[model samples]
Target: MSELIHESVLDIFCKYATLRREEMTLETSLLAAGMDSLDAVEILFALEERFDITIPNPASVTEATVGDVVNLVSKLVAEKEASPSA
Candidate 1:
């Protein structure tokens, strides 16, 4: 799960933020990297699409770094995987 989340986050940053995976770390701040509100929303949408999980509220996301997003996405994926209907 950790690896998948890590890869997914790398993909998100690479695609949306136009960042290289080598330039990112768990503590790398998205805002510090120049991620704006629209970038955040786009990343969220991309995450949902890639992981096939609903994030519920976009405005409610308080993640400050790539690690935070990774954690959230991992949790959501776990929950979805654990559900019988998923």
Candidate 2:
């Protein structure tokens, strides 16, 4: 599930990134990959819709790496799955 989330997150980032998908790595900085504040918000919105989870802190996404976002999404997904309403 985490691997699927990672791939999906990477795909989402690739949609807004100036860099090619092959050039992106987990360590790559989001800002350096041509993402701005607006892109970050869009990415967050996309993630929320894709995973059916809410991001409590939108600001952190702007400075995070691909791996960071994957981790966050994984955590959120797990939380959602664990919740009674899910």
Candidate 3:
């Protein structure tokens, strides 16, 4: 699942970002790299379709990094999996 999330992130990033995969850093600014608001929304939408989870804050989209996003996704998926379905 984490691999899938990471791939999905890179896929979306390739669609709009000029930065190479190697250029991405934990502090690399997605905005500075040209991830506009609409692009971010598109990324969120793609993530939703690719993964079966929902991120509450499209705005608070973490600035950690691609790796950070992967970690965040992993954490969220695990949390959701751990919770009992009411």
lDDT of 2 by residue, 1-86 (tens): 99999899889999999999899999987897899889999999999999999999666666799988999899999999999999
Alpha-carbon local distance difference test for all models: 0.79, 0.90, 0.70
Candidate 1 residues lying further than 4 Å off, grouped into runs, are 58-63
- On a 0 to 100 scale, what is the lDDT of residue 3 in model 1? 95
Q: In lDDT terms, which candidate is top?
A: 2
Please estimate how well model 1 matches the true structure, expressed as its whole-model Cα lDDT.
0.79
Please identify which of the two predictions, 1 or 3, would achieve the higher TM-score against the true structure. 1
User: Model 3 scores what on Cα lDDT?
Assistant: 0.70
- What are the per-residue Cα lDDT tens digits for candidate 3 across 1-86? 77776777787777877787767664666675667767777777776676777867754553445666677678878887888981
TM-score of each: 0.85, 0.94, 0.73
Q: Regarding TM-score, does 1 or 2 come out ahead?
A: 2
Better of 2 and 3 by lDDT: 2
Please, what's the RMSD in Å of model 3? 2.7
lDDT, candidate 1, 43-77, per-residue tens: 88888999999887754443478888888889999
TM-score of 2: 0.94
Query: Candidate 3 versus the native: TM-score?
Result: 0.73
**What is candidate 3's CA lDDT for residue 53?**
77
**What does each candidate score in C-alpha RMSD?**
1.9, 1.0, 2.7
